[model samples]
Target: MKEKTSSNAPTDTELKKWQGSSVREKLVQLQSIFETTKDAKLHTIAIGSSHVSFFYLSSMAAEEKIYDEFIPKLINAGEKSIKSMLEAVDSANTGELQKVLSEIVSGKTAVFLNNEKQVYLITFRNKAKRSIEEPNSEHIIRGSHDGFIEDLESNMSILRYRIQNPDLTFEVMELGKKNKAKTAIAYLKTSYDPELLKEVKRRISYIDTEIMLTPGYLEEYIEDDPWSFFPQMLNSERPDRVISNLVDGRIALIMDGSPTVLIVPTTFFAFYQSTDDYNSRWISSTFIRLLRLASFIIAINLPAFYISIIGFHLEVIPQELIVQMKNSVEGIPYPPIFEAMLMELTIELIREAGVRLPSPISQTIGIVGGLVIGDAVVQAGLISNLMIVVVAVTAVSSYVVPSNEMSTTVRLLRFPLMIMASIFGFLGMTFGVIFILVKLCKLESFGRPYFAPAAPFNLQGLTDTFIRLPIWLKKEKSNKTGSGIFNKKKSSARGWEKNEN
Candidate 1:
């Protein structure tokens, strides 16, 4: 029987030891030397030359296998025989060591010659990926509907296909102490802010971890304050959105093996924006923007409004509506706050259950829980019929914001406002709102004011911020200095047309 060797400490003697052996034996010996070390995906394969050959630990292994029959094959070379052999030896391009390493680590076969200093990389990577399809979250009418997939290389290809510019740069780095997950940053050198870029690089370099699951994982790590309810970075799946942010001097961080990309130096108001705003007509887009703002107010404040009015400001209710409201709440022994809390908690549970379930069952959970529980609770007098109405409207309004992160922020803020309304009525609600605004005003994204064009007051950037003004009317570009807005080119100019033409 063959004796099994221990995977740790193969050396048995203190003075004398084995000098060298075959590659396979050496690998087995190394495995025994360091059993605790992980992430050693070592393997071996046959390398092709002019003819079939064998190689192992010693450089002379190939010469030992060489036969007299192979002499003719080596002599029968073509006009470009040397070039063909060199090309065959070099699978991937020169000056792309990192890319070669990436492909090799992703299960590709790489050949390291005993004589040559460099290694030849060839892909055997056959991991099946999802086909390109429309983005579910970010639908568009006029632009490309296809979104990024889980494969990082394919997503990078999408960007390269769109921009095709030399200035567009991609810097790759490995994160995580153990996993060493690959993370990349893409931005236009001419368009991005140098200081902001340095800051982003600095923050990313400071991340100390292993195996980042997604772009959001890094987002949580690099966030100015994770304890704060608001998200400091924007996670986007749309390539166009990333490109647009790049054009606006924002840095986009793309993680390898993760579908989502992150944009930094974002503001609170930036979350409220949708790609549809750019696709639609200015007048309609501006109206939609305002409507979304109203939805945010409705989502956060409507429930608190109802609580304050029913619990304290009874005079504000109309007489007929007051009678209906009273009828709805008559049998409920709990105060307005408790009723609101109960319904809110139920809604949250239903939402969470739906999200956690499988795709087919998630829809079922949403419908059954939302319709059934809401109806049953109202019938049992656990919550008022009017309160259910308020909850439904609130849920629908929360979905208006394009960003799920911001929607979650508003949802969380509702609880505090509800509690405050229950305590001091409208006055308490007002105080809570003032607190939120104060927090927003104080927030900073990479030292840049979060409430740009609003608090510090840059009138020029407002051409597209809250309102989607006409393209022609947007004469000025975004100013990073918070200075007066002025167009580099006139709003109407034939010289620009000639130059562009």
Candidate 2:
């Protein structure tokens, strides 16, 4: 039997005093603190002549290791302290009760020694997690299939394997007051801007929330423009994508339990880029990049442009097209705006259904909703045949975007543009275009221009924006200075030619 403290009802200050005279008193205090939780496991065992108390969360801690390995080894070791008896792969001694509790919650077994007034935190965390698999959203034709997993340590290992440089540094901090989530900020120390890093850290520290569920939740707090439709930070599940951004002097935020990592200070063009671009030939990559850019424009304004030209600016269309469009819309009851809205809403509903249902069912819903409903609506004379064609083309174009967030933004932006076109014709679309351009120009990602290598144009950065130049032609420069625009400082990839000859 171990000694118990005299004070039965200890104050908060007394409870915090980890240097209690008796291990039983400390154990009682901890038990009282976690009495409401049924999963909390406290086991009392004898190690040598001293009494040892082990505390861990049953849901998270490895029970097999504790029972099979730790207990057997501890009982066999004679006349040894609790710390000396256990042969854990990793162990740490701490006197603070708060630290001990934290370790227990984090899936480590906390061993309390009665004789020494010391606590040893042993790591035996073996929680089940999803194996690393290719990301469904950011799929590529020819690249590494591996992606970030829900496990933070595994994600860190993936990053470390790609970039083995000493300059790759990670600064970790916990976020949220009640549900503390681990977050790590990764950057290349040699190339990343010190000011930018400081700003990012400051913003993270400023976040005072009760719970952070995902990286997306944290993103809203850290973003410069929360109201803007455009995403300021790039979210990627691919380690290759994250590694590429890190090499470009950008900072990456990796949150525990979230496969998606956020890369900061990104430009609009970055969202359009796919991992396939770097893997393919430069000319082919350039063509695909340009095609995606064109898709962005078409996805946003195709319906609106069609409405404006047919309704108000029919003179601009060739006489034969005007005649064809007039015949198509002649029997339709609703105006161009109403017709467009109906189709858009239907498509959105189908899309939402597809997402919520199972994979096979979702595919069925897409085919049934798209083919059956769309064809039926046209045959019923509810929507014009030409309008169906226009909407179909627009939907296909939106799918071409590499980033899902950007694709969503493109989908949303067309509604307002369509309304504007209905009221003011071609003039409304021009104003809408200008408004979007100005917003993009004004938007900043961590104080760096969001519409980089374009508005406030940098001629050099243009090399890889709409068209990717050959890797050999690409120059190495500080990301802080160019800010996505290439500068005059260049390196020759053919410098070894003299030695070869």
Candidate 3:
């Protein structure tokens, strides 16, 4: 039989020595890929006998850069000559088809010459994006308002601008076999523990899914206790917050399309912290920290505590308030637990509704929904006045938490405690508290204690945790265990004031 050749195959005369597969075959494959994509743009230039092609995704690749800078460079160096093509864009050369596809996926233009095996990749990914603004959810009165947008490179630049330390490093990886989302794990080389770094990367490596597009999706996989109510990592959009955490020996996970970065090995106290805490005076910050801790306690346990007192331990109530409390619940139709759940769920529904609505409408929904509903229920006698007071206080306290994840967790923890308190009164509340404390002490974030400094009882950590001391006193230094707690400085800078001179 005579040799058969396909029409798409290059002729014997057209054959040229190249490092990769035949140009015609690669072109056929790439053409198919381009056909699948809606915005794939390919421009081919003909040389005397050979050809050169530029392939890019119009949606992601910057057209101005491709045409004005890159193509001009390639053509100026002489697209007619293959040697000029190689010399012009010689930096990012890749022979593998997989690498070419990877670059293309990352919004880089890929150039293929007829005779060369390697593809020339030029990066001009679309830079026109949302400007860094204060994260509406995490706004602080005093601090850099520049928050992270959905661009990973921009976020990295923001971090680099703030933390100029040489030890700061980022490890970028392409995750998801099908989705191919880019993610970077950033940490200080000399600060964060090598073992914890390994563990973070190791957990990420184990992620086997079709899509890993969001940080939240990744967070679920790497958490120490997925079943636990507490968040293992802290979500932050503020560059200042990320920088402070990084300086204190924490690792940040930045995904390409996420405004929020995940800070790992986060402690229970971490969620309570805000950027404003650092910007404010130490005494005021300490007082506010204590208040937040109190709010956290009240948010999770206030309703439960009320139910306990009303159902079982009214003796603990002061003499003056006994009749008032009794009168409040006198005509109520349901038990305290039933009404507490009703109010809690109602608030949750309202909050969720507000979140789902547009900004202007959301604020209206929050204020009107809360006030109207609370007032209506109290008037209709669906919920008692005292119960309404407790629920309102609880809802307000939950909102005081700086971390939304922790806020949600706090709200959720309210119900179980409420149930326990209503059933067995004060004893149940005590057991519930003990159980939560035990879990908190036991819970770990990337193998580090979630309830650190308190569980391990480090005095230095307390200065920054329960209370804020002068920055000069509390310095985060690496201990032998790599706990990353604030160690007392060798000598106080303010000690000079003590001298009579």
Top candidate, metric lDDT: 2
Better of 1 and 2 by TM-score: 2
Q: lDDT for every model?
A: 0.71, 0.86, 0.82
In terms of lDDT, model 1 sits at: 0.71
TM-score of 3: 0.91
TM-score, per-candidate, Cα-based:
0.81, 0.94, 0.91
Q: Quantify how close model 1 is to the true structure by its C-alpha RMSD in Å.
A: 6.7
lDDT of 3 by residue, 1-501 (tens): 333432223234323322345766666667664555668788887655668887888888898876787656656656455555555553388876667767776788887777667778877788577987999889888878889999888899999988888888999998887668889999887777788788888998899987788999999989999999999999999998888787778889999989999988788998998888889999999999999999999998899998888888889999999888888888889888898899889989998999999999999999897789889988888888888788889999999999999999999898889989998998999899999999999998887888888987887667678888767665556522334455455545567767857
Q: Candidate 2 residues 330-443, lDDT tens each?
A: 899988899999999999999999999999999999999989999999899999998999999999999899999999999999999999999999999989989999999999
Positional deviation of 259 in candidate 2, in angstroms? 0.3
The Cα error of candidate 3 at residue 417, in Å, is 0.7
- Quantify how close model 3 is to the true structure by its C-alpha RMSD in Å: 5.0
User: Number of backbone collisions per candidate, in order?
Assistant: 4, 2, 0
Where in model 2 is the C-alpha error above 4 Å?
1-14, 17-21, 85-88, 481-491, 496-501
Question: What is the alpha-carbon lDDT for the whole of candidate 2?
Answer: 0.86
